[model samples]
Target: MCTKFYDSEFSFLISTTEIGNSQIIYEEFWFYTEFVNIFFQNTTLQEKEKERKIENVIKERKEIVIKERKEEKERTERKEKEGNGKERTERREKENLVLYKFLLEQLMNQRQKRNTPNNPRKNKIKRNENFAQKENEGSSSEEESNQFETQFQELVDSLMDSNSITRCEKYAELNHNISHYYLPIIGDFFDDTLLAVKNSLKKGSVEEQVLAIRCLLLFSITLEDAADEIFNQFEPLLLKYSLEGQNKLKIASIEALGILSYFITNTGDLDSSQKILRHCISILKNNFIPQNGGHEIYIAKVLNMCSLLLSLQANDFIGIELSGNNESDGGIFFEYIVNIGKSFLEYPDLDVRISSGRLITLAFNLKDRLEREEVVDSDIDVDAIVEIFNKLMKEYSQKVSKKTKTKQRAEFKQYISSIEECIYPKDLITIKSNKIHLEEWPKIIQLNIIRNFLGSGFQKHIEKNFLFSQLFGYRIKVESHRQKHYNKKSQRKEQKKNKKYRQQNITKERKKKNNFENQFM
Candidate 1:
């Protein structure tokens, strides 16, 4: 009886309690079975099949949302671009309308003036009779003109509310007081440019200062008359700006000084021209690079302007009479090159690098080696070459004596040698050779590269290249020589035609006479 009871109790414990090793195994197995049943029953579909369907839904929703956001962003951008473009076009149209209305009013007033007589008729009745009618007539036109002006002003006010920059589009007609239509306006404009440039130095927006200085530069290029005051007044302002003005204004002053110096030797005002050149060269010694983000572009351009100014001055001084006073100014040439050399070596820009290199190659061939050698101590060196090369290549940089790179200095030596060794100077100095002298022609090839990099700023390149006489000289030589050839060919062709016509006339006369003789026989 005891044995039977013990066996039954052991079986009951195994069935009900589940202890030790058996408990773990049973707990795992039971938990797995429960998990499998719960997972399958709670899910409405098979696990793998349901997972794929859910995942597809989530991915499609996510993709749709992402695409919507992208499309929304693109729409906003498109609207913004279109809005800006429309605003600009409207502003330009408004400016043209205002300028047109102003000119029309001024002309109408002038016409009324030209018809007026110095002496009035001596009859009081006649005067009183027409006074009311004339007044009404004048008032009607004046009211109409005033209405147009008011509309223009309202448009301008609306535009001004949005944009702070001066909204000067192309002017249909200059303001009545501007005096631009008269070619002889320089005599007056010289004074106006002088004042505007002076005031710009004192107080003006950066753009205003630039425009004012540019106008002064324009005035300095005198074709109608040689005004001493143009250069004379221009110099003091340039010197002041060179010494104390901010970066942008100072650069404008430098460019104006250089442009003023361009070809001024033809006007017999070499002294003042030299003075402008000398002051402009002063910028190279103590240049202003704006402490903002655009340091490379600004300083590079300033240096470029300074270099071109130096070249212009040197061109003037070439074959010119040099005295002790002129010798004092000679040191700046070396400094000018050195400053540009530093920009080439140190500037982190592709355009500046390429520009400085091309300018260096151009200096390669100046006839004055002794002068270049003296400055080579300071201006030409390896620092510049590496600086320039760094802009060109990411992996490689030039390694050489910091002092001896004198890239331009060495180039000057090589150019002088090549020109000196050549048996024919004219052959060595044709447009073709100059085009490839440095493998970086500014126009034929460099412009294309620059255009690819900088779009509308190519106008600046054009302005920069135009400042060089060689460019203009090259164009003029080709045009004028081609014109001469054309004229000669046209003359020869005309002569041949005339000769043929003469022979035909003689044949016709002979035929007529032969007919007469045959009739008489």
Candidate 2:
């Protein structure tokens, strides 16, 4: 509290000092001018002038302190020699410490200087010196760490200068290297990269910023066993991105949070992680239908990423609800499912609206559970939802006129059914782009991802839908018989046509064989 108060008050104190000095300097400079004798000649008192000079000097000292503070903020290489003055200030640090790590070291150093320096006990001191020597060997390790960090930064900046595919591949190699030799140091790498990301973001290069983010994301792979530690400084970078990064960066930042929340498999407690996600969910929801059309794609895309993460997070949080009623349960896992569905089924952009089967199943299950919780079991029917889905599929069926471009129809259908194991209701298509038609949509290949995953009733529910239905299903026996019958008829017709063509060619080729035989006879 006191620190915050001091910081706040100090800002105003400096502001006042700066303004006062400016006025005094102006007044003094004018004292010897032509206007001095005009109207303000003897009005200026000597004591006031003297007071102004003193204020000016104090203000200059204050200004110097301000400049030094800015300089100090940049110099975190750590002090080999103590008590660096304004004259000895550096333009940049050889290595910027992880701010938390720096704080810990500072605390240790301050304790050593104030208390340990005075301790006496000559024999004990010698013994302690040997131990301290070994402990302080961290200086050498720290040196190597700093050097490696600098080289890595240079490598990254240079790699970023190359074309994107090369940059991505280079990043992949570096990431693999960290995984091999420097696993323990990966967390600090993420922290340092935050600075570069901030710089790129400020420069307004969205591509550079996102690429930097992906580089930072590579650290996630090494964090497999020690993923919890990844959370230490993640929120700050994510918050910075949310506040200042471009659209892609913001989405990437949210995805990072999702990675943290869900990646840990079984992180003991997830309540803290959940708080950060609420705002993200809100953002996803709000951006569902953007004012202009194409903007909706970005919204859906971000939501798609967000939903997968949320599902994983919620799964971790719910952790097998034992009670009969986990009404608001499955934690973020269930919420994630619905939000994902919201993106694919509810959002404006057709291309961004689908996910692979497993995710779709997860989302559909979430909607089912959420709906079932408030309704009577009879009234809440999966089949009805399926019917609605079929309707949506029909809506998505996209009827293209025969004149439509064959290539475009194929492309549109592929987009509609991009995710395998996706299922839709009896509709031929579910969504449409401005230039696309309905018949080109892929049939919703139902995968029953949730039921296949959960087993028991889920399987039954999904399988039952697939097995029955007159207007919507293809019966195996009937389809097979029809195919065989068509094959036989087509083969006979082809053979007949071949024989007739051969006979006509032979008739035209030579009547000479017959004429010669008749003459000889």
Candidate 3:
């Protein structure tokens, strides 16, 4: 039966088998079956191994992608850190540069202070030595001046910088301690400087306009050669600004116009100066309302303009020794200014009061000059002027309350003393050794005005400027050591010559006396 079952199951395989080979066929069939079974198992195992290999390959590829992504992230993170480090480095560099600049400026300032002498006597001696050196070394001094002018030209050109702060800084630098040195340079570059100033006046901000007006005033003061031209170019604009500009702009314009007019008068253009004075007076009369109180500062500024103009006119009139009726002369303006001053003597604002005081003082000075010259029959009431001053003084004294540190109080005291000096005039010797002496209040007033305008340049101008020398009746003759020694020797020789002449006269007188005595005997 087992043989039959095997034949039935393996019928296809045994189909070709013969009956004699049945046992062999059966054994062969068993071996074949075992071989087929082993082959199938091997095929299954190989397929499973192939699938496992595929899974392992997929896992390896996934790990590679993940590693690549991680590396890319790290690279990007490193790049960002490096970028941040560069930015920080750049910022630190800029800060360091700024700090370095500040330190350098401070060091330069310290060096300057160290070089400058502290004692006035030492300063004067140094100045004399410098003057002597300048006189002795002409070509070298000229070369130095040329170098200074080149530096000044660079500074003036910087006024046109696009950055307002830079322009302002340059302006301050130009107007610093040695501003007088820039006078000739400014005259040389007048047109360019005026153009820059005009541009600022036209389109710049309020602060810039104010500074530009100040520059205009500086030009008016420093450029005596271009006085008429400056007046012609700037007068209309200054008038317009005085009338139409904002508060600070108006004040600056008025001050600039006043200075310009003074220069015009100095140039002997009396008609133009009087016209400007009239215009300023009209503005003051038309615009100033004491009851309103909002325009007190404007009124004060206008008064200042009037004071400058009237003071200049009075000074010129007195200087020329003109004889005229007080009412028919420029004295009419003088009286007008006095009246305006009296009206504002009690103004609440100190500037207004001070300006009023200046006006009155100018009037008093004019009156005194007219009387001293015996030029005009005085119509101004002296007692009334004194009484008015007394009242103002009392009022100011009442305003003060033992405050030793108040600027206003101190200014008030100084103003009072100045007014007192004007009323009872005294000679004010400005510089040591009588370099500048003011015997008239008008000249003193003009000097004060100029000093305020020129600031640190005042002394330099006083010493070196011919205009100031003529105006103040002083001569600036900077002699070298050789010239001084020659002058001293000449003086000693003259003294010896006078002594010999006196001795000869004494011997001759003695001989004459003996001859007279013999005649009497």
Ranking by lDDT: 3, 1, 2
Candidate 1: misplaced stretches above 4 Å? 1-201, 219-228, 287-294, 313-343, 368-521
Q: State, as a TM-score between 0 and 1, how close model 1 is to the true structure.
A: 0.40
Across 1-521, the per-residue lDDT of candidate 3 in tens digits comes to 12433344335343335587678777877887897788799999999999999999999999999999999999999999999889966854553443344335445545655697789998888778867875886665455555555666776788899998768756655555234442433555777888888777787787888887777666655544456777788788888888885788888888777777777777677767666767776776666664545677788878877777777666455322212223445555456667767878766676787777777776666666776776655366756766665665555465455442254444445445555564344445355366444655556666777887787767766755556666667776532422454465467569979999999999999999999999979
Estimate the TM-score of every prediction: 0.40, 0.37, 0.56
Please identify model 2 stretches exceeding 4 Å from their true place.
1-204, 225-230, 236-245, 313-348, 356-360, 363-381, 392-521
lDDT of each: 0.47, 0.46, 0.67
Work out how many backbone clashes candidate 3 has: 0
Estimate the TM-score for candidate 3: 0.56
Top model number, TM-score? 3
- Model 1: ten consecutive residues of lowest lDDT: 168-177
| Total backbone collisions, model 2 | 21
lDDT of candidate 2 over 220-243, digit per residue (tens): 433332335555545676666753
User: How far in Å is the alpha carbon of 415 misplaced in model 2?
Assistant: 16
